[model samples]
Target: MAATTIRTGSGPLTPALAQQIAGDTSHIVGFNILITDAHGTVIGSGDTSRVGSFHEASLEVIRTRLSATHSAAQARALEGVKPGVTLPILLNGQAVGTVGITGSPAQVTRFGLMVERQTEILLHQASLLRSTLQRERELEDLVRSILAFDPLVTGHSTLLDQANDQGVDLTASRVAVVVHTPGRTPVPSTTSEWLPRALVLLRESFQHRQTIAVSISANRYVVFAHPTPDGMDGILSQARHCVEQFRTHLGSDVEIGIGTEGAGPTQMRTAYEDAADALHLGRRITRRSVTTIDEVRMEQLLSGIGLRARQRYTAAVAEPLMAAGDWNTVRSTVIAWCESGFSLVGAARRLHIHRNTLIHRLERIEHLQGWTTRTAVAYLALYLACKTNEFDAAEPSDS
Candidate 1:
């Protein structure tokens, strides 16, 4: 014989889900439960033998989309039904299925309604969760397109139209911020799992209507937010707040870099590059959690030089000191003197030494290098070389 089919407005209910709902309800209420699709075909039942059977009362409930109660006499008059209460399962204002409890009508009538309500709630929650996940994926894709920085891949005109449809104005002053969490051992299998949580924290921190955030890598997230009128300071403050929020709520140690504000979509790539450069320079120079491109402009400029050229410049400028036997002392003396604005007393105090001792060191440096901290050009060269050395030393080594 051909199998019977049940149809609901939302579509036919799956037998597996029906069976699970029936089993859980039976366990809680201690009653024999039967679940039938809209056509009254018994898809699931607490009594396994009753599965795949037809129930006349369930058919009546489905037809009327109402609850029905049957006594022993009424059940005997109907086919394939016992003394029980049958409740219609409705989804979107249409009967989708039926839940029946087989027992004395007086005892199980209330329990039947309870089971119907629980089943409806479970289905509603599942539907909502599915919708939420779908929306998140769509937003993530849009963000990836925006950050991709490749015109051929992201189709600039199409993206602009989509952003407009989504109520986002790409032609606005915005800063790009990158949050990086270093030292994560054995990176998680899926970084996207943590991204939603991070977005939540960012939304709370920014409190702005037009912010876009997405994870660009396993350890980094990119955010674009419209800047306040106060300019770079305002952007930096927000970046610091974001760093604190991630650390406080997510227990993550993060370094945040804020880019110079770009006026429109065309400048987003430049802003992102600036933020990335700021992050690299900040990590090299300071222990601060938040850094802005403006704070590292000099380093950013210096970084544009080729690596070999920078190395050559450093070697040529500081070659005398590099050749000294006691290079460490000579370098420290020059650095301290420059940092103290070429003040003998200040440099001596910073070195925690007597004036004469500091003078002796400076005199030795001059004798060994033929260059003195007395000249602005010599001091500037030494300072730049020292910064280059610091940058090289701070660069991470690969195992």
Candidate 2:
């Protein structure tokens, strides 16, 4: 019985693997098995005495990359022949070893072929798994190297070279996108699994666009993409799409922030910071799923002030209202009124209430704070205080 070999460039099957195959097949077919390397020296065998022996038929099978069967009489006529079959084991399109079975010609022929097929399948799976693991490690290392880069340093030639080696062009124009998954806890067990899935989804969505995405933390991911002529609009659209996909998969809301496009590796640090700041300010100012740097640039500026100064500003303008039981209501009324350009009708319309109701709310706010929204200074103070309160709320605790 002759069968064509499938050549795969995998390494020669080890004695341990061969012995495992023989042990497993022994229970099903009840045949004595011998496993030989490409050199035809027996490395594994059901019969212990046959190990280290040479088999001519196994050598022939390896040389021709085919299977050979021998009848009992034919086996007896040849020196060191077995009344069974010898089959070449092929992996990655190359013959790596041979398997021989000693039993009745008909029984061993069928069983030996089955064993050879099983061994090839197992070896192929093992090779594939190893390759996948290696690729994942390489990808992770590349991401780490990129994040570790300090653009402000004088000598980044080594980092640039390493990035080039990984097919990432650090000199190209790139914009950073930060994805924030709200309410996600940073538990290692869950985040480790979740990040890979998110990365896969991002890659699939932006693969043709030459995007690079990496996990920055348990609930944050950074994606770099080269923007087209459409500029921030195109970037915002891509970010919105990613957030929508994440929402569909995770069944929860996600917010995305996009930074301005910047050139070269050094600018990546600034771009990443911009994206993160946009994300934070966007969550505080708007309910949109995606936010771009342009949308929150003013908030970004305001946030740069010292935290203590901002807290004092909040105290000076909104201190009286802060002690009220309905502080949130008072704050919302002031924000809506300011956002409406001090127009009672516009504020009432925005709040989905009658104009009279809005006037009552404003009067209550004025009474509580001892200041009416009449003068330009009053309007300015209230606006600044509202912004400061938001900034304070978003600030991380010192503890």
Candidate 3:
């Protein structure tokens, strides 16, 4: 067969066929055969020792794109050796790769041609199968990498859920940010290319202060943070700055949206959704190249309730306490209480205080805020506020 023809009919060579070809051509003494890609990468070989060795002959095949016969006497690397023919496997009238045999010059010439013919067919089949399998693996990795991300596109919640299951000390102090490239088409051919690089960059930036977990999907990347000694705002600001710097090297059309703080992975899903929402808002309201979740007014926590009723409820019950500037402390206390299952000890632990100290803080908040833990209405409002207030502040502006 013409070398070009063999190269063109690329297909995965079955082991059975490979063994058969090897057996048929074993008559030549110590004949070694190697198969490689156009780039000279060894893909397969008859000798196990050469499995990873570079196929130097691939360059000759790639350049000439034709069959070549050489005597070991004439070749420096094969000096005082046999003669063999290195046949290029051609597919679609092009040199895709090569296969060859080495042994006695006269006997090698005849046997090499026959072996070359068989190896050509085998390697062609092998190449096709290898290509298909590679493509499948790439697809699977893409899906996994994408799903590992916290955003809906990435399912970051799933990963965080795992962290929680492992009994990682999860708390509101831990935070994450979801950054998206707005209005830019995602990398069309592969999802892994830029996502991994972005994640590596994020990890490097967060290395000393906190653990950063990254997830990448078709369109976005979510960064999950382990508890950090630094303040959330400061860590977030530094992360954002890093992302901005990274953006400068990306394709010009790239845009990014940053999510608000989230304590752990479970809550990260909500944060991711919020960030996506903010990105939507960014596309609509701002002309800036990057947007942040905090920059968007969060959806009304009580939007489900009638506006008049919500206003009346807040005014009558929450307004006076909130006006005293003790709203956050009270709200945090209530959340701690509820989250602790009303266990004074647990709540105290969460508050990082001794039980007596916890009681003192609770009593002071109750007295100053007029929010008694004994009152069911007070408790309920506090719960709702805790559940909802994390994102209720007025939209932030420019950082």
Candidate 4:
């Protein structure tokens, strides 16, 4: 889409983006406008007939990088000329094109300058978008390379050289974040219109920091994120905000899994795997929309058991009581108590109940579950079983 964008001030200014700028500026200002490339060929004009024609007034402005004005009398001096003001379209201090207004030079000078500034702003935005897309594609390739190859295997040197050429520091600290939509394994499709929209949201949302995100599949996005000097908490906070945005805008309950920060391509690949694992496990084992691998280390360790084994273990610890109507309440109380560091007062405060009431609920749970929750062994058993039940219920059922 180079023809649709100015390439971050580095490449030729093409007609598609120029036409867009012309159309948008004309709409805003209620004026007839024309855009000419540095070569003086009219690339865009409010009057379509003017396109592909020469604009004599813009040539001098393009060459001199300055505004040029012409009166009705001076218009006769040059072929295909008009009485108007033409100003150079400067992006990054280089004149890429010219924007002109057709009217009395004095009357149109203000409008011409206004449109010129607007065009520059639009051009800069297009350039930045082009850069962001390019970076995203490169990062996608880099991530795939890192994930697919080992350092000692064939093509390692090629991967290293590619990273170097892309100006990515392969050894710098990065955290992998996997964003996935609910209910399916990812099926990658490069042709999905959804891909660009998702990539734009991710790149723009994190533009303040160094984050490269790509649509790895139809519903899965991977981001290689770098934090500020402080730590990862800031980035993760931003990520949660993005999750909220996704829910509101994308019509999907998207979840994020964050991996611990690591350096080197190999470690970054591991971080990617960890992030994916966190998302997979978190969706099954918890109600959390955002999961960090560090926070789910125990769950990860426990995930190795077979589904049948998990089903039996969870049934043993959670059943009978689970058949009762107030099982959700009991489960919440158990979770709250555990979250409150096993303090009755803290748990009572969190549940907004009296301490005696919390004790009564705990006693009821112990009576029905056939195990006292006071002992370390029993407490661990009950909690782990509750989590296992969560995972088991979340799994896809067979007919």
lDDT: which candidate is best?
A: 1
Return the top candidate by TM-score.
1
lDDT of 4 at 336: 83
Q: After superposition, how far is residue 344 of candidate 1 from its true place, in Å?
A: 9.6
Stronger candidate by TM-score (2 vs 4): 2
Question: Which regions of candidate 2 are displaced past 4 Å?
Answer: 1-88, 91-106, 110-118, 152-157, 179-198, 215-221, 225-260, 276-307, 317-382, 394-399
Ranking by lDDT: 1, 4, 2, 3
lDDT tens digits, residue span 231-323, model 4:
678767867877776666665577889887777777778899889888887776665988888877867776788878987887888887788
lDDT of 1 by residue, 269-371 (tens): 7888888888878887666898888888877887787778888987888888777677667667777898799899999999999999998887776666676
Each model's Cα RMSD? 5.5, 7.3, 15.3, 8.7
TM-score of each: 0.71, 0.63, 0.36, 0.60
lDDT of 2 by residue, 89-198 (tens): 89877887888888877777767768888878876766666665665566556556665667565357876676677677777878888887778633323533423566
Cα error of candidate 4 at position 198, Å: 7.7
lDDT of each: 0.77, 0.73, 0.56, 0.76
Write candidate 3's Cα lDDT for 1-399 as tens digits: 112212322344433444445545544446776566676654455564444445555677678977667765554564221256667766656776666676555655665556666766656666665774564354334324333454555455555454455434334444445555545533423442433455555566556443444445544655555545566555556566666656655443434555656654445556656656655556655645456666655342343455465556555655655777767776777779877877899999898878997788667756765654566566666666544553333234542
Q: Which model is ahead, 3 or 4, in terms of lDDT?
A: 4
